[model samples]
Target: MSGDDSLRAVFARHRVRLLLAVVLLLLTMLAGVGLLGLSGGFLTAAALAGALGAGTTFNFFSPSAGIRALTFVRIVSRYFEKLVGHDATLRIARDLRVWFFRRALPLAPARLGGTRTGELLARLMSDIGEVDGLLVRAVGPLLALAGIALASIAVAAAIHWPAAVALLLLLLLIGIGVPLLAVHSGDAGEAERARHRTRLRTLAYEGLEGAADLAALDARDAWRARVDGAARQLAGDDHRRRGRLIAGNVLHSACAGLGLLAMLWLALSAFQDGRVTAPLAAALVFLTVALLEVAAGCGLAWQALQSARISAGRLQAIVEQPPSVSDPAHPRPVPASPATLSFEQVVFAWPGESRRVLDGIDLQIRPGERIAIGGDSGCGKTTLSALLLRLWDPQAGAVRWGGVDLREVAQDDWHRHVAWLPQGAPVFAGSIADNLRLGQPQADEARLWAVLEQVRLGDWARRQGGLSAWVGENGATMSAGQARRLAMARALLRDAPLMVLDEPTEGLDVDTAEALLVDMAAALGPRSLLMITHGHLPDGVVHRQYRLQRGRLLEVGGEAQG
Candidate 1:
């Protein structure tokens, strides 16, 4: 679907609310026009009646009552219009975020390889926010203009056809022509504005997020320069867009002035021909000016629409992006018991890469067995784990769980049978228990402490206020070793049959790394284990060890580097 269609789909959930807002806006505008027209006619008729003194009578009560009624309607409807319109817009904004997350989650680490977190953040917050403004800025104003135009033309016609024709032409020019011209004029910068805005947000977030590292590395100035450049470009885009918006507003104002002048000339000619009275002519002039004011807002609405369109396109790019891997249409369930993993002559290459990361590899890990594989940097040691986790299927061979092809099984079902501790696992900004509970949400206090104790974090947790203690963003509050251990604890909390530890002890000292590896091995009572690392393996931790060479695994007779 196109971006426009996608955006429509996003708002479809709140369509009823949006329709109600539009109705309120139309009623509000009509009331304003009526109030102005009645007040003008009443004052003029009263003045003329007073000039005739006791010889003439004016019906003050009825017109005065009508003015009061329109005044009340205008005020009340305008208030409700704002309330309903903003409520509906906020609802759509909330849902848009949820919708984007649902669509983007399945594509992670694979199809999302090219996307940065900051860029995604900007899309989620800023772009989606601009879309939310569509209801108030674009939709409401257009509906109001339409209602005001019809009412104003009818009133003008009652006075004189020439006056009515002039009002109609003016409304059409301001409502349609001027706004369309502004929209098209702003179109060139709308997309660029969105891009630069996202880029600015991305750079700002990156700079703030990595401020410490940049300062320590003496790279703060360089990063700031880039951020400044992004800011300048974004400012330029905004300037161009503002220029068009201002130009459109000026054009509409000029047209409204000219429209009033034309309406007055027509009214005067009608009065001279005895078709319109002096009081009625004055009323028509006031009504014409009010109508012009209502229609003039169309230019601003058009500019808002242009901005919203660009935001919709940015949001659509992620919501419509294809996942790197899709689950089978008809999937089988994984084994109920402990699953035995096997790789049969698996060969693989990353998407768009020519060199094979893994080639003709065969291996197995049965229930209650421990195995470790070592490899140099960039030798696809982690690639093997990704295939095992079904993050990406092998290009050549099938990875089986309990003799069944992994692809045939539902991804979620397969995930339930295994626990994986990826290298450099992130620690979310939350309570210690909150982060750990992600692995197993139902884990009780005793269970959490037990897992923490296993990873040597139990004492630290107690000292810091136990499970309720906060872990800063990405575990910034903890030492590197503590963060690694906390991540391991999270992985260990999962009661799965198979566990894959990819450099689980990274960031710890050699002695601590070895001890952590030994602790990890001892913690696996019945579950099968596959530890992938470039470091030395702990003695007796695994039943077998292998070395990953160029696209192949070579069996080693003894222990490798820790």
Candidate 2:
């Protein structure tokens, strides 16, 4: 879907609230116009009546009552206007964030490889914030301005046709033409401004995140220069936008002045021709001044609309991007038989790369089989795991489960049947139990401690106040081995039929890595295990060993006891 369509759909979800907000805004504007007109007419009529003495009379009670009524309407409507408008905008802001997150999740790691973390953060915070103004600052104001302009024109027409024509011309030029011209001239610049803003945010966040490493490598100065460059670009873009806004504001003020002059000329001519009374002429003048607020609002609303369009486009780029791997149109049911994973003459390559990461190769592991595949660094061991997980489809042949092609089954269904532990699996900033609960949210404390014990983290958990203790940011408080094991514990708790452990013992000493492997073996109960490692696996833990070389899996050891 396009950005505008997506934004419309999001707003449609809360259309009632937004509609109410706009209506309230319209009422508020109308009240302001009415209050001004009534006050001017009442004061003018009272002055004329007093000057005429006993020769003329005026009804003070009626005009005074009208003035009081309008004053009450203005106050109440303005209050509700702000209350409802802000509520709608804030709600849409929250909903848009959630919507973007839901849309972006399936496209991660593969399709989003080129997207930076800081850029996405900018979209989530800044872009969404700008778009949130679509309801209040743009849509609501435009709607209210249109309504008030029509009402003001009709009131002017009641006094005289020339006055109405003058009001109509003013609304058309100042309210519509000026804003349209401003937006058309500034759209591209606004979009570019948003881009540079995102870039600056990305650079700033990256600098902060890597500050320690950059300092250690003596590259902090260079990183600072890059950030400064991005900031300068952002400032230039912002300055351009501000200049456009200032120009639009100046044009609007000029139009409003000309509009008021035209109205005054028309009102005076009508009063001399006896078509309008002195009080009515005064009312027309005051109404024209009040309606200028609507004109000013139109100019600001158009500027906001341009900014919102840019932000919407940014959000749309990520949420509407097609996933690298998509589910089948007519998905086959996941096979219920004991799971067996097989690679049948598979060939694959990364996008834009000439050489294949995996060649035509075939392998199979039945239920209860524990196989270890080792290879030198960069031999595509991790790529093999990615293919099996359906992160990307094989360019040729197929990875199958129980003789069914992986592509033939739903991705979620296939994932449910396998537990994957990739290298550098993240430990989120939460309690130990919170991290483990990701595997099984409903798991009790007993199960959590059991898995922790299996991964040899039970003692550490106890010392750290058990599952409730905070793990710090990304498990910072834990040792590298402990963090790795925490990730393993999460995977172990999943209890899937197929388990793929990629470098599970990475960063551990030989004895420690081997011991972890033994513990992993004891924990495996009738499940298929594919252990991809760069180092040695524990002796007798695998039924077979294959070394990946030149994109082919070659058996390097005889069948051994598990």
- Per-residue lDDT value at 509 in model 2: 88
Best by lDDT: 2
- TM-score for every candidate vs. truth? 0.95, 0.94
lDDT of 2 at 50: 90
Pairs that collide in candidate 1 are 535-561, 535-562, 536-561, 536-562
Q: What does the lDDT read for residue 451 in candidate 1?
A: 93
Tens digit of lDDT per residue, candidate 1, span 218-287? Answer: 9999998998999999899888877887888898888888888888888888889899987788888888
